[model samples]
Target: MLKNAALQYYHTVCSPNISSLLELRQSRKSNFEGREHQKYMLVKWNEISPNTILKKIESNDVELALSTLVINLRNIRMNLSPEFHAEKILYAKLLQACRTHPAWTIACSTINEEDTAALINSLRSNVATWKAQNKPTIEQFPRRDLDDSEILFIDPRYFNSNSN
Candidate 1:
């Protein structure tokens, strides 16, 4: 059952269409090119609270959330709104948490079996690097759980035109 789930996630992330950004553009249509998907992302990002995002990650929808995030990041251009910036920052934190998650690590390894050992090693190295960068914040990731205590919510106010 676990293997099956991991394989499904792998296919979802690494499938031909998903693996290619061009395919993402062609199929999603609204990704990076159209405002439709961007609008959808904006609505969903706002509708879903931080706690809900954590719940989604805990429920193993990390890939979906991460994919939507990548799409949103690519979609917005020129001006970055506070909502958009908040969405990006929040999703990025969720993604980092998911990547370092124990179960997620195993699933990722299964997906990249062609380079399983290397990938796992790389993940560990990356975790160490994130730890060095984040200090105390990094300690919460290894426990393999997402909850209110562990979430890092970013303030939308932090977004500034000058920063971009």
Candidate 2:
């Protein structure tokens, strides 16, 4: 299971690089491009009260409430919101907590081998596609881009991004 809070931390998202000085070409069709966004609730499965969860997570006690949140998210993924990933600041805190104590994260309990593999496969393909279109040079992907060290692996972290 994945949490919305963690997704937000992914800040992995990149906005369009529209140049202010660039001239627009005349076209009958629209030039607009929409990016994807996942909306996560500020609260966690009704546990970890809004204002309080933030502080607790900062102290690393976030594992206390992360399970419920992750379960809810998994349900969302398996059922209703397959293409959406909800991310909130408070949710990020829970993610941090889960990182420190993975036994508490859904990845440890809810996520099975097949689901984990499927998710990984999807991510690899997505990364490949992104790499192809953007043509990320070796220098750009240097340690930083390829690095998973930044992510704390408590229960074996899982990141999900929803894009149309």
Best by the lDDT measure: 1
Across 1-164, the per-residue lDDT of candidate 2 in tens digits comes to 32474344223321233233232221101121112122232123334332344354564333333434444545433322334344443244334434433233333234344343343343334434544655545665456454676676655234554642
Error of 1 at 101 (Å): 21
Error of 2 at 130 (Å): 39
Query: What Cα-based lDDT does every candidate model obtain?
Result: 0.48, 0.37
Model 2 clash count equals 6
Measured by C-alpha RMSD in angstroms, how accurate is candidate 1? Answer: 25.4
TM-score: model 1 vs. ground truth: 0.22
Cα error, residue 18 of model 2, in Å, equals 38
Worst 10 residues of 1 by lDDT: 72-81
Estimate the lDDT of model 1: 0.48
